[model samples]
Each structure stands twice: as structure tokens, then as C-alpha cells.
Target: MLTPPEKPVHWNVDDVVVTEPDVIRRAIGAAAIGNITEWYDFGVYAYFEPTIKKVFFSGLGDTVGTVATFGLFAVAFLVRPFGGMFFGPLADRIGRNKVLAITMIMMAGGTFVIGCIPSRASIGIGAPLLLLVARLLQGFSTGGEYGNAMTFIAEYAPDRKRGFLGSWLEFGTFTGYLLGAVLVTVADAVLTEHQLLTWGWRIPFFVALPLGLVGVYLRSKLADTPAYAALEKESEKREKDKAGKDIRTLLRIWPFLLVCMGLVIVWNVTNYMLTSYMPTYVSDTVPNAQGGGVSSTTSQVLQIIVMAVALCTIPFLGRLSDRVGRKPIAWTGVGLLIVLAFPMVLLIQAGSVIGVFLGLLLMGLALICFSSTMPSTLPALFPTEVRGAGLSVSFNVAVSLFAGTTSVAVGGLVGLTGDLNWPAYYLIAAGIVGAVALWFLQEPNGRRMWGSAPAAGSQDEAREVVEHQDREAVPA
Candidate 1:
């Protein structure tokens, strides 16, 4: 029941109000914590790919084992769309915080359980089956977790600084990734290969429980976002007048769904490429004239360095987007992917440590462009009433079908043709799709969220916004 002033015809800025800066900080922290938990699981899995293949798919030979490992990685994505379809509308009806808390518990529980599952040697066929169940649970929960988290932060952030603030969500993303990467690297360096395959991998998975608990604690401290609070009030009135289902409303806005999916496709394609596929690609897949690709440890170290760079750069680019607008920054990412995809691939193929680092760094740079901007940009594609559902479904569906499967598709294609450049080809195709989506996107910088009143960090800023609106209302 937080309420702002009534809207004015010529100046919606009448509804502009200052949200306490501390509350906004708490909200961002709460929303971002879930991302950290979720991606931490992914980071652990990606970095442990070779060991996982040995433990779970030992019967399959090297090539098939690699594909099967990546396929399990893709399994979580397969269930994400279902999670979105179920939880998205549920969030719209109940509340974002409630849905988020539920998804978080399930996500953390799934990851923790993966650590406890017995090796294939212990359980035969049942081992991989248990892993599959855990992955499905993780995927289902993630479908709900990410989109709601994005909507939650976007709604809570002030209009003028949304881009800068929203980027913190991904900051948490790389933080989790780095944490997992560092642990795996440490474990690899210290433990023998036999010890790592037997117990070390489980260590990272067990960490998810603690991370998820922290996220839950943070989220429980905050109320649902102000935008969601207001949407609840509006929904009550709509219920009295007999409104349609959220799904039906979402269907009516199909164009936004397509655009959302397209943007997600481009962004996550690059995301999984760098974070998920690159380690395997650099260490196992790429051909080296000297013999094998870079060592497993070298690949992990290179990827960690690249992720560190991206993590540090994301906030600055996000702040920059607030000033320059999201489209230009996203377009720049798309342009880089198209123009540099092959070159980056070639650099990695060179097989030297410096060559691989530069290649990964290039991809990381392209990725942060989308990372910094999309959190703020994608949430703007739908109105508040359906925002959670719209974003969850569209984002998960796109990710499940295209982005999450990057490693699998690229790996399968490479195995089929023995081509080392398929990752580059995949990136180029994604960039082309991104360019098309960008063509249709409306710039969202400095605008209030679609169905929420303007928000400001301070009373003075609110007053300034109203005055600025008044001046604009007086005609050029």
C-alpha cells in the first residue's frame, strides 16, 4: 500500500516520488543475491565439465562423453521455460518475493543435491539419472529466478539511474562465477585428478546451499517491489471489473515477446559461449598443431581472468548506458560479435596462453555490453502487470531453445565436422539476430518503467523531475 500522487494529464511526473536510497540498495542486494547463487552453480558445473564427464558418463567414449556432459548442462535449460510459464503468472498473482523465495529454495536444493548424488561407479545407470533430475529442478527454478530478479530490480531502480543499478545484478553474476572458478582452480591446483573427480567437484556444489541461504535472507527482509505493490492495487480494480488472464494479456503483446526473446537469444548466446563453452573449447575442443589444446588448468585460469575483466567493466558500461542509452551500447556488442567472431576464434586456435587470454578477453568485452544494458532494457519491454510473466517466459524460452544450447550445438557441430570455428559461426549468427532486434527496440534510457510512476533517489530529485516536466508541458 505504498502510494504516490495521482497522475496528471500533461505531466505524469506528479506521481514522481523519492524512494529511500537504503531501501533501493537493499532491494538490489536481495535481487542480485539470487543471481549469484544461480550462476555459481553454473560456474561450478562448467569448470568441472571434464570431471563430470568421467564421473557420470564414463561408459561413453571421449567424444560422446563430452557431448553428453554438455547435454546434461543443457538439461536445466530445457525445464526453464516450463518454470517460467508456471512461476511467471504465479508471481503476477501472488507476489514477486513469494515466487522468488520459492524458486531460490528449489534452485539451491537442486544444486546441493547434485553434490550428494553418487558416482556412476557406485550406482550404475542411476547416477546420471539422479544428475538429470537435479538439473531439471535447477533449470525449472532458474527459469523463474532470473526474469523475476530482473523485473524486481528494474522496478525498484530510479528512472535516471536504472541502467547503472541494474548492472549490479550481473555484477553478482560474475561474482558467483568468479567464486566458483577460483575454488575449482584452487581445488584443481591442490588436489590430485583422482581426488578431484571423487570429492573435489562436490565441494563447489555444496557451497550453493550457503549462497542460496544468504539470498533468501536478503530477499525476506524486503517487501515486494513498489512497482509490484502498485500493480497489485491496480489488479484489484481490474478483478472487480473482470480482467483477462495474464497469459492472454501476454499473448496480446506477442511482438514484445518476440523482441524480448531475440534480445535474450543474442545476449545469452554470448553469455554461455564465454562462461559455459569457452573452458571446454579452449581446453578440449580446439585443435593445436603441437598436440592437445591448452591444459585444463590454463583454460580455467584464462577464463577466470576474462571473467574478472568483464565483472569489473560491467558497472562502468552500465553507468555509461544511462548517459548514452541502451541501444547504442547493445549495438556495439552486436557489431563486435559480427566483426570479431572469427578473429577471436583464430586467436584461441593459436593455442598459446597469451593468445587464448586475448581471445577470451575479446569475447568478454562483447558480452559485458549486453550484460550492462539488457537488465534495464528488457524489463521495459512489458508493462508491470505482466512484466514478470512476460520476461520470464520470453527470456527462458529463448534461452532454453537457443542460448543455453550453445555449447551442445557448437560441440555437436564441431564433432561432426571437426571444425574449430563453429563457435565463431554461432556468435556471428547471434549478432545478426541482435541487429534485427535492435532495429525494432525503442530506447528506454531515462524513462520511468512502463506502468510505474517515476522514481527518484531523493526528494530534491523528485522535485526537479516535476519541474522539468512542467517546463516541457509549457510547449517547446
Candidate 2:
């Protein structure tokens, strides 16, 4: 059995009891809603890439405009690491709840502004430039949103069910992407392609505003996590102790960060491939291949159904991880990707809707293990004080440098190699990296959180302070 703290730590703040199922559900809802808003905007943008290219970058010509449009899409990722660095510490310092509120506003505002921007014909170079600015703002907000939401929701969870609850955060992301697909697919069915290009594309972006508002209200009303409150009290008592929350201290644990980065590389690469890039890949490659061609609308609807299946399956995998542990569950997904990528890609290449659906479903199933386990797994690697900072920095850096480039990189690789299987190859390589990292990981399923103990090499005085609190406090 895993070890627990010898005694419970005392703090000035009231314990935020999360054992109640109602509290757990609320925490899950608060964390998940913001993710829905954030990814919905991204989904809308990605699904409408062709329209965006025409409306915003028409001057570049169809070929160059396509590349430039996706290039701008990728550019937003360049700023994510910086966003993580900025927001991570703020969450660690103030509290996760308030930071969530701030990120929601930023994300919703940027997305709304994108919906309002004029076309290239109306604004010349300013259209794409405005689009770029909005993307960067949304990217910045999202960089911090995932790590902090994971941290907040994880901290609120009962240790045994953390994986399941954390998975809901990812489920929110899936739902958002699904909603984006539905928005575009439905809009296409209802409006003429010309009308979609003219104004219908903006409808999904407008939805972010209200969803973000609701997320903000839900998060703002909740009490701070018990873990963060304890850290706050501890920091107030000894301002110089840098063990749990300090960046310098966090940097010293580079090994852990690398592990986190490896996992994120796998997560983001596969994630973007399925969620962001698949439609484009299908639209471009599959139609010309074996299974017969599909319309853009058919591709979008198929993806939505696949994602809906993924959404239902994720919580079960997450709950299973809670029972069996994170590593096994994570490795299961990675293993399947390595084994199934080629077959899945081949199916997708077949061009028919059934082929696309089957291919996406297989890939989506392979991705769920990584998605569900990661939210719980990443935060537990750092102490509560530095959980936000640690997970955010590592995750965003990996995402920006590697995962964000998956679509463009894979596209280029396919162009260079004349092999449509390059995306599967890319995923296989990422899965190998993740598997290696997983081999070195210590299972953290039931680890004690921050404020449960003193620093590893703390002075006698600091030890006394920690032990004193433990002895005095009454356990729940």
C-alpha cells in the first residue's frame, strides 16, 4: 500500500471537503465547461479552414492561401509556452479558481472578436492580421487553461476517483470539438456554400461568449481547493521556503518535467491529428483514393460521430485507470496507436465515409487512454504549490515546440515523402517517445499532496513547524 502522511496538517483555512459526490460533480462541471468553450472556438476555426482561407487570405491564391491559413493556425501555438509561464505562477500564487475565471474571459473575448472581423476583400492585409491577433490571444488563454484546469479539478477529487473526474475535463474538450463539427456541418446543410463563406462560418465563434460566461460564473463561485489553501498558509508562515512552488526549485526537477513533456508530445501529436487535422487530411487525400470520395460536410459529420464515441468511452477508461493505475492505461493507448496507426491510416485513405468513420474511431480509441490519464497524472507529479507551474510549463513547451506542429509537419512530410501514411508514422514515433517515458515513471495514483510533508532536506526548524501542524490538526 502507498504511504500517507503520518498526521494531518493544520491550516488557517477551512477544508474544502470534496468527498461529497455533489462537490465532485460541481468541480468536474466547473473545470469541463471552460474547456468546452476554448476547444469549440478552435474546432470552428479548424473545420472552417477552407472558408477562412478564402475569406481572409484570398490574395495568396488557393494553393498558397491554404498553406498560409494553416500556417497562421499553427502560429498561435508559438505563444503557448509563454502563456503557460505567465499564468502558471499566477495560479500557484493566488489560487486556481480566480486564474480560471481570467482565462475564460480572455478566451471568450478573443473568439468573439474573430467572429466580428471583416474579410480580406473588406480589410486587405488587415483581415489575416486581425485573425492572427485573435488566434494568438486564444492560444495564450488555452495554454494555461488546460494545465490549470487539470490542476484544479485533480486537486478537488478524491484520490481514488481522480482519474475519472479529470477525464471529464478532457471530455469537455471532446464535446467542444464535437459541437464545432456539428455547428459547421449543420450550417453547411442549411446555407449555401457562398453563404457559409460570407457569414455562416462566424456563428460557432459567437457561441464561445455565453459558454465562457457560464464557466466563469461556475468557477468563481467555488471555494478554493484544500490543497492550495494549505500551501497558501504554509507560504505565509515561511516565505523563504521554495520547495513546492518555486520555478528554480521546479527547474531542479528537470527529469520529472521531461517525463511530463514526453507524455504531452504523444498527447498533442495524436490529439491534433484526430481533432484538428483529420478533416483536412480526409478532404485532401481520401477523396482521391480507394473507398470513394466524400464531401467536406460528410467528413465533418463522420468526425463528429467518432468524437461522440470517444467522449462516451473516455470516462470508463479513466475510471479503469483509477482502479488499475495510470501507466497501464496510458501504455494501452500508446501501444494500440503503434500497432494500429498504419491500418487506421489506410482505412482513412480509402475515401468513403464508412472508411473515414472506422479509421477515425480506431485512432480516437487509441487516443483516449492518453487523454484520460494525463490530466490526473501530470498534476500529481508536482506538489500542490508548483502543480500549476510544473505541469503548465512542461506541457505548453512540448505542445508549442512539437504537438502544435503535428498538422503542418505531417502535411509537409507527406508532401516530401509521397506517402499518405506519414501522419501514422509521426504518431508511431511520438508513441515510442511516450512509451520510453512511461517506462521511467513511478506510479503516482495515491501520492500525498503538498503541505503533507516538509522539504526533503529542510532544516530542523522547518521540520518542527511541519510536524507541529500535523500533531495539532484533527484528521477528517
Candidate 3:
């Protein structure tokens, strides 16, 4: 049997129901803490770039050590697909909550172990390798964190507030990154060179123990998404092997698969280019950036201010999406980034503190537009059963190619082209692609979910359940 083409549903904004504040709060918090740790974990290496180079990866001279450690830092992003694959299906098979809760432990443990790991002077090559292993673990955990949190929050959120609610995860992510930046800055002021090289580096990792614990506790208290629980509750009424009739069934819808993957590529390319690459781009171009080269203190302070500003605006942007819909917000942000790309690059490269801050504010503010909506926007393409697998597979694959590999590629580009504007051009290109993708895209803001839009709190009363009756319907 031929499967029908899925049509986009048009909505009058009035049709959407905004979720209650309490539900939104809990969902937002649940998503936030995990992300806090994820970025915080990554930033650990970035913030301590010099200390890491000096103490952790010995035997290299100044420039060589600095370059080598940053290389290793960039290397961590390359392994995200591994984490996504492991955790994505685990969420599908077991449940999103259980899988999300488990990763917190994995992340915390990896960080703590890194804190305790011996320095390179003591253990030679094994020490840096150990740090690499810890990084990979953190990378893996972080890979799973975003997808699961997105799916989880979207599932629980009311249709209208999907954008607003989704913003919380990104808010937490940046906030956490800022926290890591701040903490490392604190250690810089308080700790001596010897203490820092020997033990000060460990504080950030050690801090993860408590933060991850808090994340674990909050996740536990969260109500299993009513949607997922409703599925299990009703599964009791259905015949057996309905489990066989899972979300993997959607892969047969090739067009949907293509759209999801392509859109994710847009998100990753622009995002990683901005977040992961900018610091290095600044350090390399503006002299006095790496080690004493970049003001670790100034860079971090600027980041905190920039991200804090971004965080404050996210909810409003998200709420605005509830009124105007998602595509507009996404495209608007992308377009602004495209427009501002050149100016942002020039300002950051100017080497003046004021110019750098202004540039970052532009970049950070542009990012907020996407952060407000991407978490809510992406996962609507998949049904609940394979929400994990479908979202994980497409996103991981896109990220593996775009986000994970972006930093190094941009780094190499900067090294070769000798113009950080190469990265700016790249961002503009990505923004243009994203902006076009949004213009022609469907808006799912007020509609039912993937297979069918279920009633807000009513499973059986799902007003629409457009199953892809075709046996091969696995890609929708």
C-alpha cells in the first residue's frame, strides 16, 4: 500500500493552548540542570586551557602545549555521535526519564574521575590519555543530553508554549557554560601557578559531583511525561506486539527523514561555529588570547554577561513564538546572524575589550533566537515510540558531521586562511540556508504531534491519529 504524503496543518494562533506555569517550570528545570553540567563539563577544559596544557599534557613547550591541549579539547566534540547512539535508543526502549537520569551519573562520574586523575608529569602519556578518556565520556553524555531533553520537554509541553518551554534547556546550557567560565576565572585569581597546575584544575571537575547530584534529584522528582505514561497506561488495553509497532516504523517516510536531517545540519553548523569556534578564533586572531594571550578573566566575564543577557530574553522569545509561530523566530535569528556576521568578526578581532563585548553580545543575542525554539521545533517530526531513535539518529548524524567536527574545521580554516572572517562567512552561509529552510517549512506549533496530535491530557481522545498505515512507514 502507498503511504500518503503528510500535509502541513495551518493554524490560527487562537487554536493553541498555552501550558500552565507550574508544568512549564518543572519541565524547564528538568531540562536545565542536565545541560548545565553538559556544557560546564566541556568548558572545564576550555577555561583551563593553559593549566591543562602545562600540567596535564606535559613534555610540550609553551606554544606546542597550548596548541596540543586545545586540539584535544576540540577532539572531544568528534565523539558525540557515540553518546547519542547509546542513549537515544535507551530512552526509546526504557523511557526518557530513566535514560536522562542515568546520564547524569555517567557525566558526574567521568568529571570526578578526571579531577582525581594524575598529572602528566606523574604518569607520562597516560595522564593526557586519561583526560582524553574523561573528555570522551563527558562528550558522550552531553551528546545524549540535548536530544532527550528536547523530546522530553516537547512531549510534556502544551502546544503554544513549546517554544517558550524549550528555551529553558538552551538557557541552562549557556548558563552552565557561563558558570564554568566564572568558576575557572575565580580559580585563576585565588590559586598560584603551582597549585593551579597541580590541583586547582580539579575544582571545576569536582564541582560537577554536587551539580550532577542535584540534576539527578530533580529528574527523579519530575513526573514521567504524561504523554509517555499515557502510552504505557493505554498499552495495557491494546494487543501485544504493539511494541513491535514502534516509532522505528516511521523511517519508511524518506522525505520526512531528509527534512529532519537537513534541518538539524542547519542548527549544528551555525551553532557549533558560533559557540565552539569563536573563542579560539578570537584568541588566535587577537594575540594575547591563549594562555596569557586571552584574558581568561575578561573573556569569561564577558561570556557570563552575554549569556546572562541571552538567557533573560529566551523565555520572551519563546513566548513570542507562541503568538507568531516557530519558523519566524528561527529564521529571524539566522538572518540576524547572517547580517551581523562580518561586523561581529571585525569587532571581536579588533582586540579592544569593548569591541569584543559588543561583538559577543551580537553573537550571543543572535543565538538566543534559535535557542528559544530549536529544542521545541526539531522533535515534532517524530512519533513518541521512535522519538528517541528517529531524533537521535538524524540529530547525531548531523551533529557528528556539522557540530562535532565544526570547531576543528574552523580552527584549520583560521590557521590556513589566516582570517577569522572565514568562520564568519561560514556562519552567514549557514544562516542563509537556515533562513530559507524556515521560509518554506511547515509550522507544527499548534498541531498534534508526529503520528497524531493527541489531546493535551487525553490519550484516547487524540483528535487525530494519522498513522502511516503502510508497513514500511518508518521515516515519518
Candidate 4:
């Protein structure tokens, strides 16, 4: 006899809770503040690359000093995986907020200390050594800061709006960079060469301490996320488990780990290329028959305009991802990277103010596609139990190994080959990696985060989620 069709199973509406809008806003602010602080340091460092080389590596030739300056930048990334391995599971065990607080202090402190260190003229080799130590500390702390921030915001947001909310984390990122660019530009414009080299370059690094302090204060006011709290309670009700189990469980989800890393590589290579390396590339690395590439003031101004455009557009694209699936938007970005990488580089190579601006703008546009979507997309890859550890480990490893070293790798290659188009070639390679990874990514838009109960913004939305789930459950 034929079996009757099985009835569709219904999810309980009680599982969905109305999250307060105020709570979400607070969470977004707390999470984003750390990002602003972290990237602010990067912005200052990148924009001040020329000054930093003169300050710390003045003993070396210009090319070697440029490479060494980038080497110090890359040094911070090298230790990031270690920081992630320690903090990711710790955050999973204790709470994201506590770990984030600690990292904020370290990152801000590291940046502040760099400002205080004496230059090469004052202390000889000790200056670069101290700078290396500071960068390492910043790198270690950052390994923890960003992943947890992503988790903190992602877990707090309602499923339907996570993309829009998560985009604010990157909004903080661009704000930090823009602030750095503007400061560096203003300093370069106003200060005499001797004044800038002697005293002015240190000013932007000092700003990080205040930014970090404000971030710490904001984060301290909020509690752990509702999703993490739920998971903690569930673990308490069951037998208490060792934190090592979370790491082991993360290992079991190797496919998620691989996909997460792949996407991160694509996202961050583009990110570092635009935010960290582009300043140096435009102003220093690009060859000009007249001797210098773009003028420093002009490069900084062009970058500021690109960042301003990105900052304004990110939230809109993030909201768009919520309406359409994230994959479509990501595919557009990946496609642009693959197709336009060479053309954009050619524009920058043309050496006009407008050409450079348009080139940088194209690069910025591609970078934002991943930025707007990835914060929300990545945290969804693992179940709630391992979200912090999984996201942190995967994100940091990819960034440290591949993305974080973009400047050094690209610069070294260009120095060796004398090819200005290496940046374009690198971007194309990153885009190809993104396409492969995008193929594996499940459409995370509008779905509840893995291993978490459905969340809604209001009671009516809760009811709608249940009704929608029921409709989805019905067989065709």
C-alpha cells in the first residue's frame, strides 16, 4: 500500500523573540567602535608610510626602507592567528564582550606607544625594534577584536536585518580610514618638511588612544549577545563542557572553515589593497617619468574622496543585500574585479588627477561589495556554539597569511619586476578566488543564523516568520 503524504512540521512561534531596536543599535555601536579604532591605526600608518620609513628606517636606502616599513606592517598580521587561536575560544567560553574589552585596550595601547617611541636618529636601531613590538601587539589584539565584533553584531541583529546592521561595522572601518587620511593630508599640507618629519607625524597615532577608550566604554555598557547567552544557558542546563571541545567541534566543520577562509581572502586582499597599500602604491610605487608618481597631498585627497564615497554607499548596498540575496551582490563585485582590474590600473597609471581618482574609485566600489555582505555572511557559516572561535580563527588566518601582507607582497613583486600592473594582476587573482568561494556559500540572507532560534524585531514580525516557515515547509 502507498503511504500517505507526511504533514509539514511547524516551528513554534515561541522560539522567536522580539529584539529591542535600541539594544541592537547599542550592540552595533559597541561592535563598530573597535573597528574604527583598529582601522584608524592602519589608516594613520598607511598614510604616514613615507614619514614612518624616514623616522624608523632612515639608515636604509629608500627602496629597502619602504619594504622594511611594509614588513613591520606585515609583522602584525603574522601574529594574528596566534591571537585568534587564543581569544576566539576564550570568547566562546567566557563572553565576546570581555575579550573585546581586553583587545581594545591592547590595540589602542600599541598604537599610542608607537607615537611615543623615539625616532631612528634618537635611538638608532631601537626605534624599529620598538615599532615592531608595537605592531605585533596591535596585530595580536586585532586578531581578537574584529572577529568578535562581527559575532557581537551578527548575533544581536534580527535575521531579516542582519545585513544592514552588520554593514555598520565596516562603516566604522571607513570612518577610521577617512579620519586618518584627512589628518595626514592636513598635516602634510600645513607643516614644513622638517616639522612633519620631526613632530607632526606622531599626532595621528596619539588620536588612537582616545578612539580606543571611547570604544571600550561603549562595549562595557552592553551585555553579551542574546544568541550567545542562550547558548550559554543551554550548556549550563546540560553537562558543562570543556572549551577544548569547541575547538574540536570547529575542526569537525572543516568545510565551513575552508569556505570562510576563502571568502575572507577575497574580501581582505581587496580591503588591504585599497586601504593599506593603495596610498603607497599611488604616491611611491607607481613609476613617473618626471621622478615622483602622484603628489602626496593629491594622493591623500583622492583616497579621501574614494573612502567618502564608500562610506556613504556601504549601508545602502547592505540594505540591498537584505532584499536580494547576498550572493548576487557579491557576484557583481567579483565580476567587476575580474573584468575591470586591468582597466582601473591603467587609469591610475595614466597619472592625471582624474584618472587616479577614477581608478581608486573603481577599486573602492569592488571592495565595498564584499565589505557590506561579508560581516553578516561569515558569522553565519558556523553554528552558534563555535561562531566566535570559528569566525576568528578562519578570518585571521586568511588575513594574516594572504590579505594582511598585500602591501609587502605586491610591493616586493613590483620592486623585483618593475611592473606597475602587478596590483591589477593581484586583484584579478583575488576575484577568481572569490568566485570559487562564492560558489560554495549558501545564501545566508533572510535565514536565521545557524544553530540559533529565529529572531524578529517585533511580535508581528515573529508571527510572520512562523507563517513563512510553515509555507516553506509545505512540499510542492
Weakest lDDT window of 10 consecutive positions for candidate 3: 464-473
* Worst 10-residue lDDT window, candidate 2: 452-461
TM-score of each model, in listed order:
0.94, 0.88, 0.85, 0.95
Candidate 1, lDDT over the whole model:
0.87
Tens-digit per-residue lDDT, 249-317, candidate 2:
687678878888998999889999998788888986555433456788788888888888988989998
Local accuracy of candidate 4 as per-residue lDDT tens digits, 73-122: 99999999999988887777777888999999999999999999999999
Superposed Cα deviation of residue 283, candidate 2 (Å)? 1.5
Which candidate leads in TM-score?
4
Of 1 and 3, which scores higher on lDDT? 1
Q: Using TM-score as the measure, what is the rank order of every candidate, best first?
A: 4, 1, 2, 3
Candidates' C-alpha lDDT: 0.87, 0.79, 0.70, 0.87
Mind sharing the TM-score for model 4? 0.95
In candidate 1, the residue pairs with backbone N, CA or C atoms under 3 Å apart (3 or more residues apart, or in different chains) clash, namely none
Name model 4 segments beyond 4 Å from true: 1-10, 224-239, 288-292, 471-476
How does model 1 score by TM-score?
0.94
- How displaced is residue 467 in candidate 4, in Å? 1.3
